[model samples]
Target: MLSDFLALFFPRFCAACEGALAKGEKVICLQCDYKMAKAGGLTDNNNFVAKKFFGRVHLQYAWAYYLFNKRGRIQRLVHRMKYDQMPEIGEFVGHKLGAALLRQGLQHEFDVVIPIPLHKSKLKKRGYNQSEYFGSGISKALEVPLDAGAVVRTVNTASQTKKSRLARWKNVDSIFDVKDMAHVRDKHILLVDDVITTGSTIEACALSLQHAGAASVSVAAMAAAK
Candidate 1:
């Protein structure tokens, strides 16, 4: 009751568009909700994200939820979730994305969901892994457990922005280490991330998992940068 009283005077607002949201609303206004582009939840390999990993990661399936561009609403949404302590935004998008996959009968193929790990120092500074927050939402919707510890980032690498494809791959080559190979043995792992640019980070993580005995790997993200 006290919480409700406080809410009456201070209603929550959408993180992306900054509009007043009704009680229990998380983030993104109703109008902005309609603006979101569903990249793919269908069973097809022609999606933009799947094309990026073709012949590279051998994904069982791959897809992203939005086409991200500079100054676009999708970019703004990602920025808020990554830097603004708005985990609800990630969770909200993840749930909708998961539901879409479920409708397409694609959510049952994965045995486990794993988020790309950040270096320990970076996690300490950021207080959270933004990708993990999205994985949690998908895990809840898909009734699968999240393996947040399946992979570990061993080095604090420089940002990939403005870096060439070869440079990014070099930076991520030896930066990931697999943990507890036994747990991931013969499993189809779904690797999650906030975004995919050149995909070096996801590729590195997939390689580490493959070496550790993963049967297959699929990938997902909140958005894909073009």
Candidate 2:
């Protein structure tokens, strides 16, 4: 077949392992996908992810897809998505996340998917919000609408990449503002993000939505530091 001929000439490598993908393999090879970490039981409302926000926010449900280890395979994939100018990576991973959540019966739980916002300046430079791609993937799989602009970053704080957990929390207060309440007021929103480091960013946005009268809020991310 023409596809087989093309495959022989130009085999694609897995994003995580750099191993040549066999038939049916996409961004990540089957072997890598099998070995990649998971965030664990998705149904527990009081899971590890929920514990992160204890005393800070009341999450309806909260979890991540994978464990984030420094310089690991997951980290490599994330770096490509965040800095290697590979936007499609976000779309693909998000789709996978959405599909998993859907299989777990979370499809009907949220009315809308909202990405944590980026300031206009950063969005312009990045050309897209990574979290929006995640939300879009969730929207497509779960058949829910994506409200990409529900929140706005009023202040462009310094990157939390190098900051300590306490410092990250200190840098994020009052940085997010909900753009409008019409859609969020009575909806249960699923807040999506790329990776959760200090949990400050997602916490801030979740509180903003709750304060604005969202019926409830849940959180999802591609990965989280262990």
Candidate 3:
């Protein structure tokens, strides 16, 4: 009972709600997890996430696990995951996404899972890529290989926050480069990321993968802004 004694003194809090985590709970409490808004129609070919890239990129599938509301629990969870050095939060959410997709029989649709890469500078600063952790969880659930080194972010563009849609697209356009075509060539790729706003970053990454000869590219994210 030493673990229980330690927990009594140093209780772990839920990442989303900051409530004392109950036994068997990790990262997020069950109540908060249940309350988080889920993106609907994930199995549809023309789902919301897929529609975001219409006329820009051809995605084999596209889905997001949650609807991101400003100041919501998802926002807090993502903030802590990205800025608070808690990458486990991403993996937790991603595993849920992978489980959902697995239930829909979509696990085998992708040959590899590629998290959108961060620039070297940001990677060094963050010490971990949140998306890669997300991809890791998905890989574990879906039984797909996770490849973080196949692609690289060539430019460390400024944050997309507060930027107009057009500006956001321009900022991320052509910023991704495929380092090893063998990993992606003629393979169905599932691109994973934390969030999607204007969809510019995902579009850019998909385009890069397509140019590198990926047979098809799909997208998955932890959340998408409404």
Candidate whose lDDT is highest = 3
Better model by lDDT, 1 or 2? 2
> Which residue segments of model 1 deviate by more than 4 Å?
1-11
Top TM-score prediction, candidate number: 3
Per-candidate TM equals: 0.90, 0.89, 0.92
lDDT of 1: 0.81
- Superposition TM-score, candidate 3 onto the true structure: 0.92
| Worst 10 contiguous positions by lDDT, candidate 2 | 1-10
Task: List the candidate numbers ranked by lDDT, top first.
Answer: 3, 2, 1
Which residue pairs overlap in candidate 1's backbone? none
Q: Look at candidate 2 and give me any clashing residue pairs.
A: none
Model 2 misses residue 180 by how many Å?
Answer: 1.7
lDDT of 1 by residue, 186-215 (tens): 999989999987778888888889988999
List the candidate 3 regions with Cα displacement exceeding 4 Å: 1-11, 159-164
